[model samples]
Target chain A: MITVALPKGSLLKDTIRMLQGAGLDFSGFLDSSNRQLQIVESSGRAQGLLVRAQDVPVYVEYGQAQLGIVGYDVLYEKEPNVAQLADLGFGSCRFSVATKKDGPYRSALDLPPHCRVASKFVHSARRYFQSIDLPVEIIPLSGSVELGPITGMSEAIVDLVSTGRTLKENNLMELEVLFESTARLVAHPLSYRLNVDNLSEYVDLIRQQVLVVA
Target chain B: MITVALPKGSLLKDTIRMLQGAGLDFSGFLDSSNRQLQIVESSGRAQGLLVRAQDVPVYVEYGQAQLGIVGYDVLYEKEPNVAQLADLGFGSCRFSVATKKDGPYRSALDLPPHCRVASKFVHSARRYFQSIDLPVEIIPLSGSVELGPITGMSEAIVDLVSTGRTLKENNLMELEVLFESTARLVAHPLSYRLNVDNLSEYVDLIRQQVLVVA
Candidate 1:
């Protein structure tokens, strides 16, 4: 039995649609109740675990689930031991370096030696700043990265800017784009080796569906 | 007027109780409408801003609000520019180091040179481990730190453990305790200075209430 972990919000609808297009029926999940955590498909050969977007990779990496659908930003931050198969072509966004519109920074290099950059993705934020040889203090925030600059808590912020509306509202501007992100189909090594036949069948079906949409 | 940023979770009830005990009537907050973000006390002298537990300090430090009620764990992690006035005495929990029941680590020192420890408080965990000279990696997870070690995505996790039930059920064990946390009344430095007369009155009232319980 192959278990698949799916993100619970935002990308959930599209994820389910793609799975259904691949002939994996999970209409029972439409119940919209707490009991829908586990969904049994029409074929009964696969099961889906609906979990938080961040927990999908954790489930798959621990072998609780053989495969997962998650964003590139999360994968980079977590550095989980999973094989990236293909981009599912939805939930596209960018992790960018942003600062107050009136700040001294005009580019990554313009950031001060000990400046602070706030973000929920602490790991990614730290690495990106360090890679640029810009010594920075990474102030970790759970959400509302825009508030960081507005409150003068950080010199800038490194966060995912989907439409830049949040940044604009807070008077922050994007300085540099770090990574263009989209959701990806990921698999665990053990699952790939052990359930090659069954996994490939499902993978091929999903891949063909994605190509059709493209 | 004194602005108070109140946590919107487990401690919200006690927070309101304390305010009422101080002779400030804020019963309007009990109505529980998500849209009612701000509420003015019946005294018409005090107002409340409903925010996430972790964001209490941010609002206070930015002078958006004068005082805040938040957990000690959050205070330790954010280390914002706020004076710890009184321990309000609710929403208590401990930031504990937990790992799989039969995992390699027997103690914090037993962790491998590069073993990853997942947590939402990346800075807090990093400082704690570094202060002890432990060469461990920190994998920041927004929530559900218990899922990290169980899923093999991290060697251990640093997270809040109130009853330890969640960790036990997930097959994880407490390896070490990092800090004891409780909700506290914190005030901004400038607010404490500028509104010393009124702020001291509010502080004294809360202090007396805490003493009665103590």
Candidate 2:
């Protein structure tokens, strides 16, 4: 049996629908009140594990689930040892460097070296700053990176900007975007290599469906 | 005037009640639909900033908020430069080492050296293992640490357990508890030292109220 790790929250419906299109039924997850984290399909050919969006790769990496669907942003942050399969092209968002709307700095380069930049996406923020040869303190905030600028705890913030509304409501402006993010398919390397339970066939099915989605 | 950072979540109502008992009115925050992040008290002598439970200290450490109330677990993880004035004594929970109820090992010591462990509280996990001279790979999971053992991603997990329902539902058993956690009163070091905005007086008032509650 192939166990698939699916993320919770936005994009969940699409993922389930996509899988349904591939003939693997996990539609039970669509029920809002369903508390079951692990659900087995009626056919027992494949099972589903519902988990936090950030945890998709971890499950797949450990081979608990042969496959997972998660965001590119999570991929950048966790950097789990898993095979990146195909881009599913949904959950489109972008990473950006932002500062107080009234702040003097208009760009990432304008911030003084060693200035504090708060972000939950610390790894990605560090990589971006390092790539540009900018030395800045990356303060990791699990929630509300927007508060970093408002509280004067940091000069700027690096975080996912989904709708731009959260940033605008906080009186912050996007200074620079790091990258566009989309959901991608990932699988356990060993499982893929061993072709456990016709894993390659299911992978190919999803890949073709993803192309259809694009 | 003193700016206070109050955490949002399970203990928020109690924290506000405690503050009201100290004769500082911030009842506006009680409105379920209130959209304001920062609210000035009716008397204007104190203002409240509703922030993520984890970011409480960052605001205080940077002097944005003169004082903050946060979970002790967060204090242990962040270790921000702030004065731990008092323990408010509510929002009680525990940090524990847990695994699938049917797992082979019965205790933390029973786990093999360098065995994989997942946790949101990575620092505390590292410290606990190091103190006991047991080496383990601590994976930092942002959410749902219980999934660690279930998905076979790790041998064990370290996370907060409140009512233990979540763990029970997931069929995980607590192997060992590291420490009990409660909400704490904290202040910026300089603010407490310099008595900024008569911070010490308010701190003392709250401390007295806390003692009365005890």
Give the winner by TM-score.
2
TM-score of chain A of each: 0.95, 0.97
> How accurate locally is residue B90 in candidate 1, as Cα lDDT from 0 to 100?
77
Clashing pairs in 1: none
Worst 10 residues of 2 chain A by lDDT: A142-151
Each prediction's Cα lDDT score? 0.82, 0.90
Report residue A203 deviation for candidate 1 (angstroms): 1.5
Task: Please give, for residues B69-118, the per-residue lDDT of candidate 1 as tens digits.
Answer: 89999889989999899887777898988889987778888888888888
- Per-residue CA lDDT of model 1 for A1-214, tens digit only, reads 7788888777888888888888876656656664445666778888887778987887788677787889999999999999888899999999999998887779988888898787889999999988988888887666666766765668889999898887777778999999999989999878877765489788888889889889
Per-model TM values vs. the true structure: 0.71, 0.95
Clashes of 2: 0
Comparing only chain A of model 2 with the true chain A, what is the TM-score?
0.97
Alpha-carbon lDDT of model 2: 0.90
